[model samples]
Target: MISPDAFHAACLGLGAGLALIVAIGAQNAFVLRQGIRGEHIGPIVAVCAISDAILIAAGVLGTGALLTAAPAAVVGLRYVGAAFLITYGVMAARRILTPKALESADPESSGSSRSGRAATLATVLALTWLNPHVYLDTVLLLGSLANTQGPGLQWWFGAGAMLGSIAWFSSLGFGARLLRGFFARPASWRILDGGIAVTMVGLGVGLALGT
Candidate 1:
């Protein structure tokens, strides 16, 4: 029952959402790790997808332009996000130095660690919300793009963008288990941790430098 123009706008939104989201970054890495561990996958994926949906809606409502006007707010968020990324990167590096298997490191799997469901969820929330780049992407970039579709069809574009988030996070959080066999070895965990550390630190530095 959808009109051709609406369909086209939806397609554009979907493509843009995917292009912005489906990249190597801290959020994706965390989702992949959680998926592999088979711990809190549902809650984690739901949080990410829902968060994106809300942000996209905000963007489509023209909040992105409002945010763009707030240069000081953006700068503050950028520094906070950089600090968070750096801190997370340091944690990843510590995991590598500890010489424990990734599976064993997870309290959810071993039940001996201090991190509980609440703690894990907190971490997920912090990772998603603390990252200022997320706002820039979902709010400013996607919002501006959606507005360009004209007022009547912008909501369709936002809906399509939300669909993209749902599809992507679902795939990432659920589909990551397919690689469990490859990550069975401790060395794989170490390598993954190293990559994660590098990525986080690199991104943190990039944000700090504003490059």
Candidate 2:
């Protein structure tokens, strides 16, 4: 049975978690686009939420200390993540120039291609794992905060953070269907893809420069 103080700590963690997870970023943009396209929404949401849970758990378990001791690992991840983002951005830009790529988002587009599904899965995983900001936010920040609650209550706090992750991803993924009508137009696809390309490139450059 949980005590009152532990439960209170959980509430605090939940609020903090929601505040962090609700921010706009590359992962949210990718999830929103995939959600609007109605492509592998369940799998994508599951991957993101589960990934967060794992990270949050790691943070509570003091993995942040390990990271602090191993700065080189983080540096390597930053460069690799930056490269992936830039490459994906270029692909998005290419799609804007190719009529076929733009048309693939049409309402009548078929999901019969196994390769397409695999590609989407890969992209989702990349966006989730490759971002250094995720480590900074979830592991370092959250871990430091959870430790403040003391060992007796930290796990409860982590649980609350995990719940926050699940709620935010579910709302973002499934609720994105509300924008389906707007995305139905080809012009909308062009605009969305263009924005995505710019965002990805900008983030990649920032990561590469370690800014």
Candidate 3:
């Protein structure tokens, strides 16, 4: 029979990963926007999956525990992350409200660029790195949680969590791509931008409120 502990770890890891990822936030929303626009898929997925795997591995290996011991450090990160997310959200909202005319579209930020592979990588790095909370949640919190599951099953647990990350992100990419064809209208951009803005602002507020 499969070890009960391993099974439990797998379930917990999967659940935790999915629970955290499913919520629409800056990263997911931005990915959706790009996927919808038929932008670079490989680099987007790479950014998401690689970041997740690295974080999950760190979590499982119990490397992020250092931060957990220091309450002040995590709190500091939370505030900084919230501010950045709010700024990002507001900018996205502005883009929606004042989308440039098709004839005079301005250059996109490196993250939103339509260039080749280099721009694609740049986008992923910027999006993932801008938010400090990635470390708090994925590294410290999840790592601490995994450490409690016992050493024997930590890898399995981490693997399940990784799967969850892959599933959620891939879905976000492909699903967004599918919708892109039908919802490529100008009005659709507004709707998506509005939704992203709301999600980002809400998350930022939640982070700031700490409850």
Candidate 4:
């Protein structure tokens, strides 16, 4: 039988993961674009959500334990992830503050290519894979916590976390479609991106501090 601790940890994992995952970002941007365009939203969302589910589940099952069991390596990875997250957050905040003045950002960007779906999927995959903080949160922290529930509860806890990821992304992707038309103007997009940037930066900071 699963202990009360395992159940509790699983619920915490779901809440924490969803709290951060539900926000806007590069991946969320891709989902929003697809949802608005009404192009391959199902596949894109499924891929993103499923991929995230797998990673999160793996983290809980034992991967986190393996990483965390090693004192030096875990500490090293934690700091690395923290540094990356802090840097990413600062960059996101900068983008939000100087939306127009940012010379490096492309002021005019549009894509109507036939392979947009594939490109979007690839981008989401890369975004998930490249994020070190994700590993820190999902693989190390969540994983270690989930393992505490023992075998009987780990899978269930993972299921809750998986559902959290799916629900949040689905809502974000579909909800953004309705507002796509209102964002026709450059100023509108700037505001939207600015919002996303702030959210991303805020989440990034939170990840760095493990708060």
TM-score of each: 0.93, 0.93, 0.79, 0.65
Clashes of each: 0, 0, 0, 1
* Model 3: ten consecutive residues of lowest lDDT: 101-110
lDDT of 3 at 66: 68
Q: Which pairs of residues have clashing backbones in candidate 4?
A: 59-143
Model 1 spans > 4 angstroms off: 104-115
Over the stretch 1-211, how does candidate 3's per-residue lDDT look in tens digits? 8788888888899999888778767888888876776567667887898899998898877768666777787677677767867876797788776857111111232234446667656756755765556777888777777777776877878887888998888888767756754564677777777888888788778778874
What lDDT tens digits, residue by residue, belong to model 4 across residues 54-125? 788788667776665676664555555545444544554565467453322121244435596677667567
Better lDDT candidate (2, 3)? 2
**Superposed Cα RMSD, model 2:** 1.7
- Let me know the TM-score candidate 1 reaches against the reference structure: 0.93
Segments of candidate 3 deviating more than 4 angstroms: 1-8, 101-123, 209-211
Model 1 lDDT tens row, 14-120: 99999999999889988887777777788889999999999999999889988878989988888998998899999998888786546743425645233655676
| Model 3 residue 142 lDDT score | 75
Evaluate model 4: give its TM-score.
0.65
Candidate 4 yields a Cα-based lDDT of 0.64
Ranking by TM-score: 1, 2, 3, 4
How well does model 2 score by local distance difference test? 0.87
Q: What lDDT score goes with residue 15 in model 4?
A: 85
